[model samples]
Target: MRSSTLRRHLGLKHEFQYRQWCKANDFTSMIPKDVKIRKNAAEAAAASQTIIDDHAVPLPRKERVIPYSDELFQQAAIEWLIETDQPISALEHPRFREMIGIAACATNGVKIPNCKATRQSIIALFKKNLYDLWTQFAVSNFCCYMVLSAY
Candidate 1:
């Protein structure tokens, strides 16, 4: 197959990496100069079976290794959670609002600029009506449950 056709078929990226890899290896000279590209009776019979044997070698199949990255996905869920609520809902109280704030801070390690400023921001952000954002964040733990289940 034409290289361009195969590249397009595979959605092959023309990135620096593949170019570097191609430059590092000489496919044409992989066999001795005397050897023909196509298999010939003389070449096949006299040649070490190494080349053909290498072709028969199968790559190790990648085992499914689902990772549990609670920290990584916690932020990812924010987008989905935002979809479920309006910014108005983002301000209103949901379930377990206080617990929600502490958990959100703990899970994401939410920190204030400094402890004094953090206290001030928490006081401001967790006012009665707006505290619901924390509950929404705690419910985010359910997404963590999802990553756990895959393993």
Candidate 2:
């Protein structure tokens, strides 16, 4: 049967719902549980203190998370705007310019190695540092800010 017809018959609006319906029909509706959580619980109950496994191979060490500072990020943002020729005033909307500024600064080479900024991270950083960005960049004596205020 066509997907639309099946959807209409089954009243499924999404693919996950269809998969759930298939699981129900196939008698495998129960979702799989994590093996590690169960093992951890069993070990906790069995021993007074847990011991580390020396025989187990150690996982690779992750890179240290560097804390963000406003000064460094703002400098990067200004430099990025200058280098990329994406001056804040040229953008149509104030909010979009601010968001781009945040992305440019927050994903600086020192902070995010290779600077592959995700939209979610940019948005989060922008929201977290909204006041700083506004006071430092938006309401400042910079030419761009003066032009933005005029609009």
Candidate 3:
């Protein structure tokens, strides 16, 4: 049977729904708890990319995170942006860009704002021109208020 025809018949919400049906009928041993959260396929392709294995460490107070001064983080982000430019969205992912900026700023004796830029365009601008980006978004947006705003 064609996939579209099957889709028309079952009217499952998505691919995972069919997987759930399979699991319920004993086609598989277990159903994933968070099937909605798809794994990043690009990360799998980049075998050299370091997977952050540290999930157990508790998030410390704002002052607790060791500031990024070593330049290692910046280098990695630059490598990705410069070399492949594959998924421009990495520059867009708030989590990824913040990590890069936090590490870079901390190394420069500047505090990594508890908040960081959210818009992808602004984030890209930040990479190209820091002062201009700061002027437009207002540096205050990336300051400690971001923690509360983030929530």
Alpha-carbon local distance difference test for all models: 0.56, 0.63, 0.59
Sort by lDDT, best first. 2, 3, 1
Off by over 4 Å in 3: 1-79, 82-85, 108-151
> Model 3 over residues 38-59: C-alpha lDDT tens digits?
3444446678676677755767
What would the TM-score be for candidate 3 when compared with the true structure? 0.18
TM-score of each: 0.18, 0.23, 0.18
* Candidate 2 lDDT by residue in tens digits, 1-151: 4754654544434546755776778743222222355677788888966556776788796666556688975787678779989867645567866766676565433344344566777887888798787777754668786788899
What is the TM-score of candidate 2? 0.23
Best by lDDT: 2
C-alpha-based local distance difference test score of model 3: 0.59
- Candidate 2 lDDT (Cα, whole model)? 0.63
The candidate scoring highest on TM-score is 2
Q: Over all chains combined, what TM-score does candidate 1 have?
A: 0.18
Error of 3 at 44 (Å): 64
